[model samples]
Target: MRVVLVSLLVVSVTCLPQGAPPTVCQTLMPFHGGGISPQGGIPPYSIIPRRQGGRVAITVTSSLGIPFQGFLLQGRTPRREILGEFDQTTTQDGHTIQCGEPADSLTHNNPGEKNSLDVIWTPPDGYEGPIVFNATIAQSYDTFWVGVESPPVDISRRSVINDPSFNIPRQPPTTTPHYARPIAKQSSTEFDPFYSGCAVTKLCFGAPDNCVINKSCKSAVAVTVSGDRYEFELKADNAAWVGVGLSDDDKMGDDSVIECVTRNNRVDAYMSWTSGPPNSYGAARLSNPQLGIQLLNGSVVDGVLYCKIRRDAYTNVNGKVFDLINEKYNLLIASGSSATASSVSFHDLSFLASAQKQSLSDVSALAAASKLLVRLHGCFMLAAWLGTASVGILLARYYRQTWVGNQLCGKDMWFAWHRTFMILTWALTTVAFVLIFVELKAWSAEKNPHAILGTVTTILCFIQPIGAYFRPHPGTSTRPVFNWLHWLIGNSAHIIAIVTLFFAVRLTKAELPDFVDWILVAYVVVHVISHLVLSVLNCTAEKSSERRVTSFPMKDLGASGRNSGYNDRSPDAPFSNVRKGLLAVYILIIIAIVIALIVITALAPIEETWTTLKSTVMDNN
Candidate 1:
């Protein structure tokens, strides 16, 4: 019994070291099985690239200067396939392992803590694609993180012409001579065939709607169908990567994506999956045994990246088969400036989806999802709060005594204009509120406070008119209560509405420039100055009168002559001309501000629009 127990104790001790497995090249997961989750914070280690002629030297070091116990590193293609061989001569504290290919991956040999590891990697001969070094760092057996990656490395070949007479090498021209010409035959090397059959023999989708014909698209895609084969062409200017996704709906999640990435001065194509938003944890490379996609041609010339790909008509992605011939899908196009071997960054340059699902076999132009409603919503809101509401409040507050004797349609001139402007405010606000809801179709998911504040302002504005309709008569006992409540609600709503407009500048959909904040600030300054000028003028006029007279009108004061410390003034009130001139100036300034804001809101993403306009003007000049 003692001999058997000794053998069992030896076996248990041997198994205890299984936490750091020797065969981690395949799954890349530690065998620490206590149900501990991987760390969710930023990893402390990073991979640095140091490349020479045909080889890349990679160093995995603690970014925070914290030592690590174990690590596994590999050079991978954009599709996350393990590539490149590690040179054993330069590898330290690690050894190469076979991950579907011989010596294609490296892992730590022991569990000892180390500050850094260095290795030299060589790409496959004649391979000119995007490469990145990915690492998994283990601070301890139970505390490790995966998907830490380095920046992409450029390793493309450069074609040069050597002149025998001069014995000097010259790089090839970066722009094609026939770039501005009409589309040529597929067999011709003079021009690109991407825009050849757009909208006539193939279905094309692009931004600006006329980019296919004009050849000025910021991003575009075309699909050509031939029996069981579907060919796709993608193009984007000044982009690190461009992709087209086939989604069941207009949104992004659960979609299959085909990307054309610019790296190493060349373009390469890959298949990826969009599991959620296009963030670090959302997009991932598809690991299908057979991708059924072939890259026919790819190039980057004059800052434009183009690629042509051939894919099976029926392709499986993430266990679902997408049929291009009979079924319809929404085409989502996006481009950005950053990408890794296994994921893409957010689409900050351009992002759009087709207005409706489209069949790949149909040769028709696709329309982009319209932002017309969004623009209109912004215009209506600005006109209501900034234009109508401002004028109405000014007329009710400071101009009530200035337009004393004049009557229109049996109502005082001041009251007549004030009621008309306020009614217009109510109508415009209601319409604007409805239009925004129609555009979004649901509550916004933005993290900003704009949506919440706008909703609250709209609710308060809607309640103001209803409360006024039931207000007591001017001399009634509850008249004072009604006046105070009216003043409180009206001022609160106006202030909140202006504050909400400031937040609108930060909204992604607004796309307004940073200078827009200054415009709002200018409006606030002018508005406050106008109020101060009017208040001072009113005090001067009251003191000049021989008898004490109330500045507020009888209707506003809301009490009998003796009941309240107020009385109505004569029609010939002092400072009438000065007040009229100030009112005119204020109206002009308000109109100018409102028009400027509305124009900016309508032409949002204004930086691009301004650039285009400046280019046009320069060309004309």
Candidate 2:
């Protein structure tokens, strides 16, 4: 059995008002397992004296069972590797009891043998602020900042037997620049004393872009009172962000739906908006995560917009133990006036508490990471296209020469390359989507639902290979669907390719390659015209002629099914040549669309698009 000792101490909570934990800790659970205390839990740690050079050690022993089984000491305070993981099952009075792990990080952790800890708090050069400490049981812990409470100083009222001051070096912690405090970077931009929807396009406590501008919202951050919901903006700095869109339609699911915006892939911090749907202004990101005197969890609070920070979404892996992740947040308010207020209130708060102050001073880290993913994803589409196209065009030539599955068709090395390429393409494409999505929202398939149109296109892309691998001898009409699906997916790939290209051009205007756009456009047009002429030739040549022309395995067909069986053909019937030429024309038109998209994305800012879309919608109303 375990012994229990409780002590009550009074404390004040000036920050917490009603419903706060009682002003006194009525139960002081001492760290005792056998007769000795175990090392764990909330502050007031039994600070051991420095043994060698700035290292403090504490011993943990238990007669009944081990404390903190599988354990490791982490974080910046007293970094220590995991001593070891223990699966200690101790028998108490002949009953086997599984005692849990050590948790200097959170409560309910059992420390095994050598439960003692060696901690070293090297405050930056002569620093003296109470080094803050927080423990997260595991990943699912409520992401909240833990407030530092000072340890009782005087011994007259029966402070423990150990001399408290001995724990802290007598040298007096003093420093030039305190690590606890961050020197604010004075921004060069000045806030407009008078707010106008048009003038103040971009906003926030940090660097931001221009907001939408119109009658209702002359700027991206402003909004006019509407018959329905209000609009607002929220931003996150140094963290992954998720937007909570509020809606009245219960059918859509919740009153609020969270849209994940940023990711923690780049480390530092992630942020997202806790923005309710259409409250005032359509939400927007205002700044990147950075150090601030006051932490706002993950939100931006500027009186006009109140964004409170909270913990990142997580899953629990153990009992009562949760790991917390750092996130940033910002809020955009579209009130009638640009008046700021301080009346923000919230219940049940949690956040990833940081005991140290740091900044993402490692320049080029995020940009480089995002750029790498973009390039990687671009390569996936490129590989799929090049791989399939080579086989298709080559087999098309061979088919015209051989009589539909002639002996010489499958006698070459082409079929091997075709299948290999298809397999590789699938893997690459999947990886590309996952990696890019995890880094940033740029070129995201999720942000725009229209992007899935590419999926249908990719399907037709590899279908030919499978059919070729199956029979190597598909009827004329049977091969056409393969051709058609290939065409569709190829076109979709072209669209997605253009988008990724546009992103590259927009980000690195000087480094963009010119040949990509030109080659893509020219090839599209040429292919369409060529397709028409070929269709006509096949038709006029007669059915016997079409049947005679089958070379190679139709090697590129990856997916196939038969219906009246003339393999999926791409021939334009009726006007044949005219239709083919018109298809060429369509290709040219879309090329123009691609250019328009690129120009708008690169030259014109989104603040303008928001305004245009808003105004056009308004005028129609």
Candidate 3:
């Protein structure tokens, strides 16, 4: 008999606490209304409230497997009259409530496959008004903020507390330690049950509310009213760190990031702030370590990394703070190789439309500006390279003597027209060059072939004018050398400039429709045909010059009342078959250029055009 007594004493010392367990009131019957039936879970079972002494007891219940996270009970009798604050023991599914705080919130310490909680709230001394309870719970994977309000309970019925039917079963002796999880002290970095992490080894709960999945990543987000914190869960298709952030301006700059990374086979979490795009992530700094950025859980499935993170919407940390309660926020998700790295280090990113609306007004403005610049640049390029330059070259090469009798500005007529057209072309081309720089702020030559070619052509054009200014006099002994250099540089520059113009057309096609290409094609055809006509006329004059030198000597030139050159002309002058053949050849060349233009524009490869257009759009984005 003494041995049995000793065994009982030893068991009691090992199991029971030295002090009495916290006491809580029993919940009363007569729940208010029918519970709400939500997706993926049954309706709330019952919400019973009872009073014992100074504390009020409220029990919330739901079916098994319902993902209920927490609840909020607010007094509604006379509005904020006699607030009930949680401070004592609460029970849920035979486990003690772990996440309760000093506020009107009751958060479970551990998540259970089933949902139920018994909470104790203290009312003011001598308070007599009826109290109302407003409860909110996280339904399945933090998917939705489900809520319900209880009818007012009149405290005048004193028998509700003494009735045997309303009595709660006595709590069993404590076998596990229960620690107070006060919110004001939750800033600790050590692991705590209140904000303990969670991981998804498999797709648990089978497609939670507001879940979005693609080939690269899957994600879902939920928020709660306790300091307005957000809980994020992401499953990336690749093994990489996943992150989610909130932005006030829908941009990476001035945003807060919560990330989870797997390094050396160990999963870790980080919080950071950004001031630039993802590529500039090196500038992003780590957030305050005490700011309560917790990685609740993480796992790997089929080479994909899944992570769950929680953080408050507002904090006093040394980073961008998001006011999730008062202001609308934009949510962004990204994946990267390095957990500690900045957002720029990530390879893939997604923006959720539900979090915040994206404004395209700025993008539209930029696109409109780019379109205007491209069209203006294309026009200036065509006018200068094909119209002015082409005409000037042909006139100087073939019609120099033809215009001698009709001089302008104290020079040959063709030279005067050439100078005027070139001046106008130079002015317009320079304007276009400046406009391009304005449109493309960085003037990225590597990305824009048109900008690079334009710069080269502009340089060549600039040097040609400088070279012309230093030309020797026409009658000097060095005049021949000067003319050769002048003509070589001038013609080469024109040819290169024109080639650059062709690429400009291709660039324009990227931004504009195919009809713009047709317009350019027609313009080119007309210019080429005009050049051929000049060539034919030049060849015919050369033949006529030879006849003059052979048919009449320089001694007899003065008697014919004409210059010794081929200026002499009459209706009876002999016409060569070679000249007529050259004219016929020129006509055929013109017809061929026209037909080629028609065929090329009509049958332009749709695939190639589409590829180019897609490239343009991607680059712009």
What are the models' TM-scores? 0.56, 0.29, 0.37
- Per-residue lDDT over 1-621 for candidate 2, one digit per residue giving the tens place of the 0 to 100 score: 122222111112111111112111112122122122233322221121122122222112111122222222212222222111111111100111111223112222222112222233222233222222222111111111123221111111222233333342111223221121111222311122112222222122111122322222211121111222222233332222323322222111122222222222111122222233223212232243221111221211121122222322332221121222232222221111211121111201101111122111111111100134445555555454433443335334332332223233354233344345456655665675676545443342122333353444344444534544553244544565655555455445545544444334323211234445564565455655655555555455445443432332333343343422234233322333443354456445544544544444332334444665676899999
Query: Would you list the rank order by lDDT, best first?
Result: 1, 3, 2
For candidate 3, the TM-score is 0.37
By TM-score, rank the candidates, best first.
1, 3, 2
Per-residue error (Å), model 1, residue 269? 8.8
* Candidate 3 lDDT trough over 10 residues, lowest sum: 360-369
Residue pairs in steric clash, candidate 3? 98-109, 197-296, 198-296, 198-297, 278-344, 279-344
- Candidate 1, superposed: residue stretches over 4 Å from native: 1-243, 247-312, 315-321, 335-349, 361-365, 547-569, 603-621
> Which 10 consecutive positions of candidate 2 have the poorest summed lDDT?
360-369
lDDT tens digits, residue span 394-485, model 3: 55554434433566877756568777867766776788787666544444322336666678778767776777778655445665565566
Stretches of candidate 2 exceeding 4 Å from the true structure: 1-357, 360-368, 390-394, 397-399, 402-434, 437-447, 458-519, 533-621
Deviation of model 1 at 478, angstroms: 3.5
Q: Scored by CA lDDT, what does every candidate get?
A: 0.71, 0.29, 0.46
On TM-score, the leading prediction is 1
Per-residue accuracy of model 1 over 405-500 as CA lDDT, tens digit each: 678887777778888887888888889899887776666645579999999989989999999889876677887887778777888988999999
Name the regions of candidate 3 deviating beyond 4 angstroms: 1-371, 445-448, 505-510, 514-533, 547-621
